[model samples]
Target chain A: MAEKHINARGLQCPGPIVQIFKEAQNCAAGDILCVEVTDQGFKKDIAAWCKKTKNELLSLEEEGGVIKARIKKG
Target chain B: MSENKKTIIVFSGDLDKAMASFIIANGAAAMGNEVSMFFTFWGLNILRKPEKIRTRKSFMEAMFGWMMPRGAGKLGLSKMNFGGIGAIMMKSIMKQKKVNTIQELIESARALGVKMIACTMSMDVMGFKEEELIDGLEFAGVATYLGEADEANVNLFI
Candidate 1:
């Protein structure tokens, strides 16, 4: 499966999620999306979004101020 | 699985409020939720056409239409506006922050298939004809908004 990297840094609420959602739409069912966001609120938002969209969250971690998440599309 | 529905009543015409409502609507729609935004009262200004359209109006209607800000681009902030300067500053900050403007958000929401409904009663009160507003909007009354809200899991009044 192909993998995509999304840099959603410097965006506020809904920006990061919107970017991820838009990118995910162009990907195949089994593709992987690695998203990096600077919005602190995105930590919880991403989990909730992944749950609602039925995407599998591979890992979520924070390095410095950026939050990184890997999600496999379901 | 059944799709979730969201209904938002956009009652405020302030730039910040409009942005908030659109942001929520766009986010919900992107998450595969069916989202509907009902524009009523002052909120109808968000859907107004920037360019003046030739429409017959009474003296009072013409005055009201003239006084109200036309379209999304002319909207002002609800607080600390300093007579529109705050709105200009806010737009600059939004640009620097790389955040989408209200126009872009509305376009994105439309692209995401979010339903936008303008309140017929408000249009009547405001003397706004269909041609006076932006295109791609469904005109309806409160009953229609209530019906949409009834099926929605989340209902918000902004």
Candidate 2:
């Protein structure tokens, strides 16, 4: 499967999630989407989004106020 | 009636409230939920067109139309607006934070297939013509909103 990166860093609230959703629409099943965000709410939001969307949260990490996530499309 | 359906009644006209409605709608829609927003009362102002649309109306209707802010750009915040300066400051902060503006949020919600319904009763009371509001909106009444809400698991009044 192919992997795509979404630079959602600096976006706030739903901005990062919406960007990931928009990008995910173009990806095939099993494709991985990597996203980075600076929004403090993203950690909880991303987990909830993955659960609701049935996507696999491969990895999630935070450093220096930037949170990164890898999601495998379901 | 799908389990993954949401309905929001946008009752207030404040910019902050409008943004909140759109943010939730967009978030739910991104998570693969169907979302519907009903605009009524002062919330109808959020859908108004920015440009002046010439339409014949009664004196009170004309006055109401003249007094209300036109479109998303003109809406003021619900609190600490400071005679509109707060809205300007908020917009600047959102820009700095790379947050989407209400205009962008509305566009994103539309693109995500979120249903936007404008209340006909409110339109009549407010003297707003169909052409006076932004495009891509469904004109309906409370019954329609109720019908949508009945099928939705989450119903919020903003």
Candidate 3:
């Protein structure tokens, strides 16, 4: 499976979420999506998204002023 | 529920209430929800032309009301009075946290296609001229809002 990358740093709340949805549309099963966001809003937002959409958050970690999250499309 | 495809209605225009509108609308829009912020009555004031809507009292309040950004932005907790000193406290916190202004959030929402509709009946009642509002705003009546609202699983009033 291939992993898609999204750099959403400096973008606020729904910005990352909107873009991620747009990006995920182009991906297929077994594909991985990694997003780099700045803070808590993304974590809250993405978590809820994953829950509702049935996607899986494979990994979430913080590094260098960025919050990294990965989701594997189920 | 379809992720990021919910609809929300914002019925308030107070500074604090507007903040709730901004946070909620943006929050929902972030979830990939096709958000529609049906701004009616006072809510339409946010899209008012920058120059036409001027503040009368509270210079500091006016400055924050005017300078910080208008409409959805004027709604921030910082710009609002959560309490006597709450506005001030929130402003400081926002400055420290680097959160986007309500205007910026609205702009971002538009960029993401978070359809924003201004209520026609409300505007008429309020005597707001078309030119006084921001560009790219979709104008519609109650029925229009309802058509979309009916399709949405999530609906809210603020």
Candidate 4:
């Protein structure tokens, strides 16, 4: 399985999600993407995006004020 | 599930409002929804060229062009403008937060296939030249906007 990492640490709401969407374009159906972000709004945004896009959100974690979301492209 | 179209009438040219409108447009487009934005009156200023294009125009037309904000980058805040300083401060905050600027958001929306329609009536009334606006815009009248709005599942007047 392929994996991708997106450093969205400094990005705000929708910026990180937009970046994830852009990156997800090149990935295969089962590829895993890890997005690192600092925006608190992303907690809900990513979940909603994955739900809308029919992707699988594997995990969401926060560490030292940074949020990381692991998603599997569907 | 079939109601997936979103149409927005962008009536304000203020930076913050424009940013909000574009953010919504982009988000909707990202979710595979059909998005259309109609620019009217002051909203047309968001699509103007950043630099003066030096097009030949009548004196009144020239004055109108000079008085309006040149482009997205030059737009002022809708509130607490503080003589243009507020816009500058807002830009700084956006940068620090890594939020896309209004210009960047517009580009993203376009790239996401959002239909950007410029109101010809507003353009004529506001003295905006066809060549002075950005590329890739579809020009139409109120009928077209109304048609799109009528079918859109989510219609907004901003």
Best by lDDT: 2
CA-lDDT, candidates in order = 0.92, 0.94, 0.71, 0.90
Candidate 4 regions exceeding 4 Å error are: none
What fraction of the genuine interface contacts, i.e. the true contacts, does candidate 3 reproduce? 0.34
Q: Whose DockQ is higher: candidate 1's or candidate 2's?
A: 2
- Tens digit of per-residue lDDT, candidate 2, span B1-158: 77799999999999999999999999999988999999999999999999999998899998999998899899999999999999999999888878799999999999999999999999999899999999999999989999999999999999
If both were scored by TM-score, which would come out higher, candidate 3 or candidate 4? 4
Measured by DockQ, the strongest candidate is 2
Q: After superposition, how far is residue B49 of candidate 4 from its true place, in Å?
A: 0.3
TM-score of 2: 0.97
List, for all models, the DockQ compared with the true complex: 0.62, 0.80, 0.41, 0.63
Of the two candidates 1 and 3, the one with more favorable DockQ, higher being better, is 1
Q: Is candidate 1 or candidate 2 better by TM-score?
A: 2
Residue lDDT tens for model 1, B12-57? 9999999999999989987879999999999999999999998999
Superposed Cα deviation of residue B139, candidate 1 (Å): 0.7
What is the per-residue lDDT of model 1 for residues A14-52, given as tens digits with 9 covering 90 to 100? 778888888999999999999999989989998999999
Model 1 RMSD to the real structure? 1.8
Name the lDDT value of residue B70 in candidate 2: 93
lDDT of 2: 0.94
TM-score of chain B of each: 0.97, 0.98, 0.74, 0.97
Candidate 3 lDDT, B1-158, residue by residue in tens: 43345666666666566666766676676555678888887677677766655334455544434443344434434344654366556756766766666667777677767788989887666656566678898999889888887878878787
CAPRI rating of model 4: medium
Q: Indicate the residue-level lDDT of B2 in model 2.
A: 79
